[model samples]
Target: MPQWSEQTLASFERKAKETKVAVMVTGSIEAHGDHLPLGCDLILPTFLAERIAQKTKALVLPPIPFGESWPMDVFKGTVSLRAGTLLMVYHDVMKAVFRHGFRFILALNGHGLNTPLLRQAAEEATEGTDGTVIIVDWWSDLAKSVRAQVLESPEGHAGEDETSEVLAVRPDLVDMKVAKGARVRTAFRVVSASHREELLPRGVYGEPEGATAEKGKAIMKKAEEELLLLVEQLEQGKLPITEK
Candidate 1:
């Protein structure tokens, strides 16, 4: 895959200017669970962005290794950013990408909360630039694959689905011997009424009891196929997301 960070200024200018579309891959640094690493959010999107770039012909930027994760702050190693800071910094990055001459941008987001913030950044990137920006939540987009291939119930943090995915990419990071399942149905919003402790008692929200490397591979494969199709539609003027 052609990477923006690896290219010399001259080479980047030559290829990036002609490409017209680029993908900024990013995720958050937060707690998943006892069995997963703090970089779980960072790993999936960065890995998928490279694979997506191979087929999309768009330049891939180095993934942002941190994100806005207020809800998970109570957990150990749960690094987070202020919402305002994340919004402004992300907006600046989008503007910079547009200034570099890529008019179409796909912001591949790994963390869930970052999606709306990225959409805000994309709005700023689009103003006066006549560019198109879209945020693809890799996990949410492939929920079908998760349901069909991995978990029978909804997947949660460091749960069966996510653990399987990490196992696929970085199997050494998983210690299934200590893996556990946690399911909860919140009475209100997780961000507003319920914090991490009230929402996920054991630091997880989905089943991780039977996760495996093979299941992760299946989830990834399904996501790749679905996302590639979405990219094609975007090129044809169809947006993959809808406003609620």
Candidate 2:
């Protein structure tokens, strides 16, 4: 499948009708750490979407690079969007894709804060219509078990898992020399605006120093397999939920 941004209008229309599915990657421009790039969120999901689309033949939409990151807004590179504004952006994009007769949309989210809003936007976009949207937070959702298998440290912003992934996709951008983090041991969730600063003073939450390209490749391979399975199911009319 072709990237939506690169497709000619005529080719896109023709291919979209044949494909009937699209994959959109969403993430945030935020502070990952001193070592990782601010665009870490976008890089991983965009990588996943491109890999999956190769097999599934789904059109890959351009990435949505800003998300709700108010918790990390204090960080220098963090660009946070208001909840409503992010929701509207997602809704509008999904609706536009659906309107073009591509009913199945796989929204691969990279930021945790964007998950609920993405869900809401997906629901609103497909309501009263035959369209269906599958929202996947690639790291938390697809790579959860893989993290346990391959990662030595707990997951957090720019942690072992994420650093490893970035290394696998773009090793040139990673700086392992200064990679560091504090082990975050949270009992439960709390609403503290200064959470990142207080708990993670270094702006990192896990052991990024332990990150390796091998672990990252392992995580990505599992994610790709699972996503391929999902796309297969959707193609077979076995997804998008059916009420009992």
Candidate 3:
């Protein structure tokens, strides 16, 4: 395993020199309805990180288990962080990794709200340096083709896609009997604390009843392939790959 915590000092130094790439995964403890656990965000990214590290030999940092969960804070089991706080944490972690001589930092974020902050943090951390930061919101950024094929319902918080992922990674934690879905209010971008509930009455955005572990596995497999390709591109100094 390419995990950071499990490595000895000498081993870490050697491996870090060889890879020059560090991956930090971020997630949140928030309400994912009654069927999914509060740690769904944390679990999914961590699962992907482990898979990526195993294949690419990239150093996987210990996951940041908190995120900006303001919209969902009205619900129980939701742990929210001030935007500034999460930003600083990400910036500091990237800075620390850079200090260790790793120039390529990959941030794998599981929560949707953390995307912008993660990008800002990366920008601030790598400014005026040779360091490169790659921010990936795994669910939305990777495996587009697979998602279109595997998911029938539109993507939403605690929806079909997420539910299937949970079932694939930790079936024991999912309560399929209580699984349900709700449509989000996209009429207007109303900013309110109650927006989460108003938009998703059931705390879910898509049909979880349609989720299957098989679909989750397919999604993850495709995501893993995409992630590994990105890392390979980084290794070959061919990063920032853009298509026309």
TM-scores of the models, in the order given: 0.89, 0.92, 0.96
Order of models, best TM-score first: 3, 2, 1
The regions of model 1 sitting more than 4 angstroms off are: 143-146, 190-195, 231-244
Clashes within 3 Å, all models in order: 1, 0, 0
Q: Model 3: how far is 138 from its true place, Å? A: 0.6
Weakest lDDT window of 10 consecutive positions for candidate 3: 194-203
Q: Which pairs clash (backbone N, Cα, C closer than 3 Å) in model 1?
A: 160-207
List model 3 lDDT by residue over 71-126, tens digit each: 88888888999999999999999999998988798899999899999999888888
Better of 1 and 2 by TM-score: 2
Model number with the top lDDT: 3
Cα RMSD, model 3: 1.3
lDDT, ranked from best to worst: 3, 2, 1
Judging by lDDT, tell me the better candidate of 1 and 3: 3
lDDT of 1: 0.80
Worst 10 residues of 1 by lDDT: 187-196
